[model samples]
Target: MSYKEFLVQLSEASGVSGYEGEVSDVIKKAFKEIGHEVTSDNLGNLICFKKGKNPKGRKIMLAAHMDEVGLMVKDIDANGFIKFTTIGGVDQRTLLCQEVIVHGKEKVYGIIGVKPPHLTTPEERSKPLEIDNLLIDTGYDFEEINKLVEIGDVVTIKRQVYNLQNNHIAGKALDDRVGVAILYYSLQELNKLQHDVDVYFVATVQEEVGTRGATTSAFKIQPDIGIAIDVGFGKTPELNQFDTIEMGKGPAFTVGPNIHPGVFNHLKTTAKDHYIPYQVEVAANHSGTDAWPMQVSCSGVATGVISIPLRYMHTSVETVNLSDVEKSGKVLAHFIASLNDENMEELLCY
Candidate 1:
């Protein structure tokens, strides 16, 4: 499937942090289509294994999260209005009047209800709306709504991927869905290479809440090298240069405390040798991705991070450049092909 088509389907699937099953199914099918051995761990992480030419070679893991920030029904009012708590890191500012899909006994469409500007007092208008005060109106009366809606139902922002100028696209869940798509494409590219390392493509869950899936999966895999593919802040007018990487610049490989210097250098060299357009990301301490947990897994796994630049993170309109997404897949495939028995031994050495 094409990247655009894959992303569209992925973005539309509602897979909130603790509820990633829906998205996992789609990913599992994709992996199976490519003939990879797919399995799910007790923690819901989907692992796809592609055996290398050398059966005893180094194990390399590529991780991308399958969860997106959303909401969960907390209460159902007598009048049929649904009250919810933010699932991950939802921005209250983006909640007003937005369309959402509530996963209850049945699929229900709802809209966040905001006080009409004219109805709000001047004091209220001066302050940001609190999440506690937000309500989802499904247009169903109490009796009808109660039968279909219940507390604890997952809620996701409703959005479809839309293409923009300059090879960019915007939609919800691109934060990591795009990363997952990159993995799919990378696997495809790897099929054409003579890599000597076993590759584990992990579609991890609950990364929005924490790097929960990566933590457990990395421990189980005990990979020689772990690479976390995730979304990073993209440059926008509202963001400063130091805070955001540019979109369309190609995939970014991180350098920092959380990243193994040797692994980072390896990826950097691979990108340079292949002439893949790329960027550098500096994370002072925690990389705030699966890399954080993967780095400390087991005794210690040499971990690196490659991120796709995304705009408007954790919102329904997250955006990324498709060109950069494609580039990331190629870079990963090339990096894996470059890992030989000799270099794998030096992956973590200073």
Candidate 2:
């Protein structure tokens, strides 16, 4: 599938944290077409294995999460307004005035509503609005809404993924969905190359909630090397120097507690050898991605992270560059193909 098609389909799918069945189905079908043996872990991670010339040479696991930050209904007010609690971290300022999908008996449209400025006292308008004061208006009475909607249904922002100027793409859920697309394309590219190591392409679930899927799958796969593909913050007008990376430039190679130095260096060297553009990301604490779990699984796996430069992360209009996405896929495919039993041994020695 084309990158544009992949982005649209992933962005449109509602797979909030702990509810990733729909997104998993899409990923499963894509991997099946590439002739990989697909299976699911106990925590709902979709693991696809492609056997190499030497099945026992080494194991490499590439993971990308399939969950997005959204909301779950908590209560339906007497006036039919819906109250909710976030499934993952959500900025309250962005939630106001945004459109949303209320996943009720069937999908229903709703708008996040708040007291109008005219009604609010000047003192109230000056302070930041609290989440409890906000409500979702679905244009239905309390009895009617209760009949179609339940307390635990998911609620995602209603937005269409779009292509912006300068090869940038914008939409919701690009945080890890873009990672999912990159992994899928990389598998397709890897199929054309002759490699000596077995590779597992995993579509992990509940990463936003706490990397739950990766933790379980890593213990099961016990790979020699693990790489988590996810989205990183892009340069924005409001962010400071340390907070943003340039867009359309290249993918970011993470350096952090979650990454093994040997694996990171190998990836960087491979990128340099292939003349692929790449950026460096430094994280002092936990990297907050699937790599966090994969690095410490069992006896500990050598882990690394690659990220697509994304703007407006965790918002309705996240943005990414198409060229950056393609280059990330190619770089990963090349890195995997460059691995061999001897080289993998050298990685272990470090």
Candidate 3:
């Protein structure tokens, strides 16, 4: 499937943190259609295996999370309003006036309601916003809403993927779903290449809550090399050059203690040899991605990270450049194509 179509199907589906069943089905179907041997782990991670010509050769793992940040219903007021709490890191300021799909006994549309400005006191206007003060108005009374909605139902942002000027697109859940799209495209590219290493492409779950899916998958795979595909902060007016990468420039890779030097250098060399545009990201500590867990998995796996530049992360209007995503996939495919026993020996030789 085309990247645009794949993104729409993924973004429209709601798979918040722990509740990733709906989106995992989409990923499993795509992998199966691509002729991969796909299976889900106990933690709900989607793992696809593609055997290489040399089954005994090095094992390479590629990970991209499938879960996104959202809210869960917490309480219901007598007036039929709903109170919700975040499932991940959520900025309360962005809650007001946002449309949400409440997943309950049935799908219900609701909006984050705010008090009218006409009635706001001067003190209220000066105070900071809080999620506790917000409520979701679904246009149903207590008795009516009680039958359809219940506590613990997931509430996801209701938005459609749309194109933006300058070859960009905006929508919800682009954070890691964009990574998932890259993995799909990379698999398509890898199918045409001859590589010596066995490849396992994993769509991890609950990454937003904790890197739980990656942890379990990495332990099970025990790969010789692991690469985490995720989204990094994109350039915005408020962000500094050191903190964000420009959208459409190509993929940015992490370089730090968390990243293996040999793997990092291999990726840089592959990009240069293939004439693929890429930027280097410096992380002093952990990269805050699946790379961290993959690095420490088992006896220790050589790990690297490739990230697409994304704007308005964790918001409903997260934006990314499609071309950049494609570039990342192609670069990954080339990197995989170059892996072999000889390179593996040198890469692990300290």
Best by lDDT: 3
For residue 317, model 3's alpha carbon misses the true position, in angstroms, by 0.4
TM-score of structure candidate 1: 0.98
Pick the winner on lDDT between candidates 1 and 2.
Answer: 1
- The runs of at least 3 residues in candidate 2 whose Cα sits more than 4 Å from the true structure, single-residue gaps closed, are none
**Per-model TM values vs. the true structure:** 0.98, 0.97, 0.98
Prediction 3 global C-alpha lDDT: 0.91
Any runs in candidate 3 off by more than 4 Å, and if so which?
Answer: none
TM-score of 3: 0.98
**Shift of residue 20 alpha carbon in model 1, Å:** 0.8
Error of 2 at 19 (Å): 0.7
Q: Which residue pairs come into collision in candidate 2?
A: none
Q: 1-350, model 3: which lDDT tens digit per residue?
A: 78668877888888999999888888888778878879989999999988887767679999999999999999999999999999988777788899999999989999998888899999999997788888999999999999999999999999999999988999999989999999999999999999989999999999998899999999999999999999999999999989999899999989999999999999999999999999988888989899889999989999999989999999999999998988999999999999888888998667
* lDDT tens readout by residue for model 1, 45-95: 999998888767679999999999999999988899999998788888998
Candidate 2 on 27-64: residue-level lDDT in tens? 77777776777899788899888887875658999999
Preferred candidate (lDDT higher): 1 or 3: 3
